[model samples]
Target: MNFRDYLLPADSPRIAAARGVTPAEYAQRMLATEKAQNLQREWQTLLDEAFRGITTHGKPQPDLFHLQDEGFDNTCAVNAARALLATLSDEHHQRVCQPVDAQQWRAWYNPEIPFNDFGVRLEQTSVATREAFRRLLRSCTSPSGFEKINHLMDANHFLGELYDLTNIMNRWSFHFMIFGEPSETRPWGWNIYGHHVAFCCFIIGRQLVISPTFMGVEPNIIDRGNEHDAILFTEEERRGLTLMQALTPVQQQRATVYTLMEDPAMPPERFNFADQRHLAGAFQDNRIIPCEGICAAEMSPVQRQLLLDTVAAFIHILPEGPRQARMAQVLRYLDQTWWCWIGSCGDDDVFYYRIQSPVILLEFDHHSGMWLTNEAPARFHIHTIMRTPNGNDYGQALLQAFQQYTEAE
Candidate 1:
C-alpha cells in the first residue's frame, strides 16, 4: 500500500482531543505530526548513537561519518517537526514544548547580532554539540570523509540559528496576516526568509571545502545586528579593528590587517616583530604583507598549502578585462593585509592572500560553482570573517598602513 493509504486520517476526534483541537483539525494535524515526529525520532536516534560511539572511544569511528549526509536531512526534519508542533493547540504540548516567550523569541529570531545577546551560550552548547559531532567525524575513512561529514556539526549549528531567525520572522509575518495588508514589516519578513535561505545554502556548501578534517579556520558568527538592521561582519573585522587601533602613527596609516597561521612552536612575537618591519616596506612598494599580531596556531602544512594554492589559482584563472581588474583590486586589498598562512617545523610555509576588502554586514562563501575542477571551487567552506575600517578603538593599523604608503613617497 502507498504510505498515504496507511496514514491515519486527520478528522478523528480522539486525535483532536489529544491535540486540543477540533476533530477535523486534529486529524489533519496528526497526519503531519505523526510523520514529522517519526522522522525526527529516527534522526535523533541516529545522532544519539553516533554521539555515544564518539564519547565512549574518545576518537571518531568510521561509521559516524556515514551519517554526516543526514545533516541536511535532519534540518528538514526539524523544520517539519516545528511546523507540526505549530499546528497543535498550545494547551496540548505545554510540557514538552512551549511557544517561545517574547524575549526568547527575540533572541532566537534576530540573526544580525551575536548569540550572546539572545543568551544562547555557544561555548556551553557547543560542548554537547561537539561531542555529538565527534562521533560523526570518526566515521570517515574514505577520501570523501572531509567532503562528506567534516562540516555537519557546524552546518547543524547554523541551522539552529536559522530556525530561531525564521521563527522570529514568521512571528512578524503572522502579525501581518492577522492585522491585514502587507507593509514595510511584511517586506522585512520576506527578507528574513530570503536571508535565511541564502545563509543555509552558504553554510551547507562551505562544508564541502573545509570540513573538520582539514584543520582550516571554522566560520563563526561574530556580530549580527538588530532585527531592524541585520548586519554581519567578518572575524577579520573583529580582530583587525582591535589591532589597527594599537599601531603607532606611522604604522597605523600604512597598516592593514593580515591573518597568518604560523607553527605553534614559533612564538607569536617572533612572527609579528620579525615580519612587521620588512612587510611594511613591501607594502610601501605596493606589496602585500602580514598583519600585525600574527596568530600562530597548530595546523597541517598540507591543508594550509591546499587553501593557498586554491586561492592563488583562483587569481590566475580569472577572465581578462573589467572583471579581472575588479578581482585584482580586491586581491590587492586582501593581499595587503588579509593573509591565511600555515607552516610546519620542517615544511615550507603556505599562504593565501586577498586584496578584496572583506565584506562587512554580509557573509560570502567561495565554495559554490558547477565547475568542480576549478581551484577554490568549494566556496562556502570558508568560515564567515569580516573586515571594516578601523573604528576609534581599533583602526590604528589602517592609519599605519596609509602613513607607510605616504612615507614611501
Candidate 2:
C-alpha cells in the first residue's frame, strides 16, 4: 500500500482514539514535512556536493585499487557484470545503466514511505533477466551476506501478500544499475535499491566497499508463514543490547538518553538531538559528525570484545579477505571508536544506539511502526545502517587520496 494510506485520517472516533488526535491533526502532525523535504533536497543536491571534485569520466577509475594486493578476486564479479551486459537488451540497458559518477548512486532510502525506483525493476523484466541480476549480486557479496539481503526481499513480499497490497509492495520491486565497465583491474560498481533495502557495491581491483548500505523491516517476525519464516537482524539487535547490558552503571549514565525511541511526551530538543527518525540514514552521505559518548579505551576487556563482536555483525557482509582487512582496520582504531545509546536499556524496551569510528558509522534503532498498527516504538519495526565516513562512501575519498599519491610518485 502507498505509505500515505497508513496515515489513516484521525477523524473517525476509532482512528482518533488510536493516534490520540483529530483527523485534521492526524494529517498535519503525523507527517514528517521537514525531514521528507530535506531528503528530497539531498537527492537534488548530491551530484554537486558529495561528488563535487569528480571529473566526467565515463570509464572505471584505473588507479582505484592501487592499495589492494589481496582480499578481492573480481573474476566472478567481472563475469557476472559481463553476463548482465550481454543478457540485457538495448532498451533495458538504456533504462538501467547509469554513469559511474551519477548522483543516483547516492539516492537510497529505507523509510516506510513510498518513493520512485530507478534502473531495472525485477517484475518488469523477464525471468532470465532477474536471474542474471541475482547472479551479479551473489558474485560480489559473501554467501551469508547475500542471503540476508535476499531474505529481506522475501519478507517484504510476504507482508505485501498478507496485507493484500502486493501491487505496491511486491518482492521484485527492486531496481538495478551498473556504473562504469566491469573489469577486475579497475573500479566499477552496482546498486540494487528498493523499499527497506539498498546496497552500493563498489569494487576496485581486489578491494570493495559497500557503504551507505540500508536494511530495515516492519514486523520483523513471520508467525503464519511456512515458506519463508525470516527472523533476521536479531543478532545485530541482540549484540547491541548485550553491549549495553554489559556496561557499568556509571557507563550507562554516560550513554543512556533517558528517552524512548518514540518522540512523544518529549520536548523538541530531545527529538532534534536523537532525530524523529534515523540519524545517519540514507541521503546523509556527507555528514561530518564527530565522535560522541564513551570511547572504547574506557571499556573493560569484556566490553571491548563485545564491541568488536558487534562491529563484526556489520563488517562480515563483505567477502572473506576484505572482511578480514576491514576488521583489522577496525581493530587498529578500536581505542578511537565511540559507542552511545538512547532510550531504555531493558530488553523489552525499544531504543537506539550508534557505533562510530574513523572508518565506520553504524546505527541500530527500534522504530515506530508504519505498516503494523503499533503506535509506540517496537522491536518489530527496525532501522539499521552502515556507513564509511570521512568521504570514503563508494570509496570516493580513498580513490582521491590514491590519485594524489600516484601524481606525486
Candidate 3:
C-alpha cells in the first residue's frame, strides 16, 4: 500500500495546531489534554505498584535468569561511553549521568514529545557530543541494529517533513542518558528514548541485557528520491505474517485470540487509546498479562523455527554475542511459550501478534494513526515492544545476583 496517499494535509488540525510551538511547548499542551492526563495518572499508579516485574501470572518464577558471564567484552562500549561523557560540560554531565538503579531508566516514553525530559537531548547537543553519542551507539549495538535506529530516526524526520512539523520530530530529537559510570568491573549501561523509539540496556561484566525496547514508525519509509530514502520493519512485518500463514488451519484457529483488532467481545482492559493492543508498554513494569494462545510445544520443528526467526527480528538489536545468549534463553523456555494474534492474518492486513514466554514478552501491533487521522489501525503506523518478563527487565535480577555474589565475597 502507498503510504503517501494516507498523508494528512498541511492545514489539518493535527499539523496546524502544533505549527508554531516548540517541541516542549507542544508536549506541554498535549500533556494537558484529558486523555494524556489520564494516561499519566495510570502510568503513575503502575509505577507505584510493587515491582514484581512483568509476568505471565501474578508471581515471577524463580531462578530463570542468573549472573553468569557470557564472555562478551564491552570494553569498546565502555570507552565510547567515557568519550561521550568527556565531551559533555560539567553541568551537562551531571544531567546525563544517573545511578544504575535510577527511576529515569523506567521513565522512557514513545511519543514525539515525551513529558519526561530528564536526559541529554541530541538536538540540543554540540556536534562533538552528538558524534560521541553515535560512536557509543555503534559500540553498544550490532551494525544492522545501529542502521535500523538511523532509519527509524530518519523516518521520524521524513514524517515531520510531510506535515511541516520538524520542530517536534527531527532526526536528532532523541534523548540519551548514561546510567552509572562506565566500567569494566561494574554494572552500568545507557538508555536513549524519544518518539517511536526507546531502548534500555543494562550490563554486568560480560553479560548484557537490552530489554524494554520500543521501536516503531508511521508511514515506515522515507521516499524523497535521495540517499536518505529507506524503509523500516519489513523483516519484522513479513516474518510475523509468514509465521501466521505457516500455521495449520486448526493451529491458526487456536492461536487467534480475536478475529478483529478491536473486537466487541474483548474485555475493556484489552485495548486502550495510548497503547492500543499492547499490554506491556512504558510504565507497565509489573503488569500481569496471562498467556492467551497456542503453546510452542504444539508447533512442529519447522514452525517453531519460524517463531524463533520472528523473535530474532526484535532481539537482533543486541550485539551478536548477547543476541545468541538471549536466543538460548528463549529456547530454554520454548515449551512454556505462547503465540497469540489479534485480527486476521490475511496478506496486507493490519494486525497484532504477541509471543510470550517466562523469559520474554514481545508485542507487535499496527496502530490507528495519531497524526495522519486514520480512524482505524493501519499498516503504516506500527508499534513493537520487547520486554524481559519475570523480573529480568533492565537486568534487575541479574544485577541483584551479581551484587549478592560480590557482597558475599
Candidate 4:
C-alpha cells in the first residue's frame, strides 16, 4: 500500500494536537492515555518476573553461551569510552555513566519523547561529546553496522522533518550513556536509544555481546533528495521472503504461524499497540515465547542455506570477529532453530517473521503507522529486533559467567 495515501496533513487533528508541545509534554500526554497506561502496567508485570531472561520454554537452557576470547578490539573500545568520558564535566559524567549491571540498562524505550531521561541526550550535548560517542560506536561495530545505525538516526531526523516535529524526532534526539569503567579486562557497555533505535552492547575482555537491539523506521526511507536518503531492510525483507518461497508447500504451511498480520484466531496477547506482532520488544526482558513454525532440521540443504543467509542479514550488525563467533553459535544450534511467519510472503505484502534458537531470537515486523496515519500494517514501516535468548540479553549471561570466574579465582 502507498504510505503517502495514509499521510496525515499538518493540520490534521492528531498532528496539530502534538505540534508546539515540548517532547516531555507530548510524552506525558501520550503516556496518560488509557491504552498507553494499560501497556505500561502490563510491562511492569513482566519486568517483575525477576529477569531469568528470554527462553523458549519456561526454563533457560544451560551452557548455551560461554565466555571465550574472540579477538574483539576491546582496547580501542575502551579508549573511545575514555575519550567520551573525558569530554564530560563532573556533573554530566555522573549522569551519563552507570555501573555495568545497572538496572537502567533494561529501562530503554524506543520512542521519540524522553522516557525517564536517564542519560546524555545527544541533542543537548556538545559536539565533541557526540563525536566521541560516534567513535565509540565505530570502535564496537563493523563498518556496515555503524553505517546502518547512523542511517537509522538520519531517518529519524527525516521523519521529524516530514511532520515538522523536530522537537521530537531529530537525529540527535537519542540518549547515549556509558556503563562501568573503561577497562579492557573487565565488563562494561554502552547504550544509545531514541525513536526507532535502541542498542545495548556489553563487553568483557575479548568477548562482546550486542543484544536486546531494536532498530526500526517509519516509511523506511529518507527520499527527499539529500545526503541522508536511505531505503532500509531491503535485503532483510527479500532474504526472508526468499526462504519462505524456497520451502516445500508443506513446510511453508507449517512455518506460517498466522495467515494474516492481525489474525483473529491469535490469542489476545499475540498483538499489541506498541509491539504489534513482536513479543520481544522493549520491556519484554524475560518473556517466555514458545517456539512456533517449522524447524530448520526439516529443511533441505538449499533451503537451509537460504535460512542462514536470512539470519546473516540481521547478524551482520556485529563487528567481524563477534559476527563470526555469533554465527558459529547459531550453526551449532541449527537443529533447535525455528522459523515462523505471519501474513503472506507476496512481494507487495507486509508481514512479520522470526528466527529463534537457543542462542538467538530475531524478529522483523511490518507495523501500522504511528506518526503517519496508516491504519493497517505496511511494508514501509518496520521494526526488527535481535536478542540473545536463554539469558544472554544485555549480556547478562556473560556478565554472570564473568562474576563466577572472578569468584572462583
lDDT of 2: 0.71
List candidate 1 segments past 4 Å from native: 1-326, 332-409
Q: Write the per-residue lDDT of candidate 3 for residues 163-226, one digit (tens) a residue.
A: 8888889888888899989999899989889999888988888889988899999977779999
Error of 3 at 250 (Å): 1.0
* Residue 95, model 1: Cα distance from true site in angstroms: 25
Residue 345 of model 1: what lDDT? 13
User: lDDT tens string, model 2, 1-409?
Assistant: 2223343343544333224332234334434468656656655675346452221122222332236654687899889888888878898888778876677887765643344456776667787778888898888789999888888887777666655555556677677789878888767889877768888888878888888788887767654548667787888989999999999999988876545565466555345422344556656565545566799999999999999999999877788988988888789779978998878888777788889877678888877656665566778777788877656677776556556766899
Instruction: Check candidate 4 and list the clashing pairs.
Output: none
Residue 131 displacement (Å), model 2: 0.7
Q: Which residue pairs in model 2 clash with each other?
A: 10-23
TM-score of model 3 (CA atoms): 0.97
lDDT of 1 by residue, 253-308 (tens): 33223323333565553333212212211001112222332211221344333323
lDDT of 4 by residue, 1-409 (tens): 6667778887787667568887778878878878777777776676666778888788899987888998898999999999989999888899999998888788778867565678878887889998998999999999989999999998898888888888878888888888899899999999988799999999999999998899999979788887767899888999999999898889889999999999999999899888899999998888899999999998999988998999899989889999999999999999899999999987788889999999989999999988878888988999999998899898999899999999999
lDDT of 3 at 87: 90
Error of 4 at 391 (Å): 0.5
Where model 3 places Cα greater than 4 Å from the true spot, the runs are none
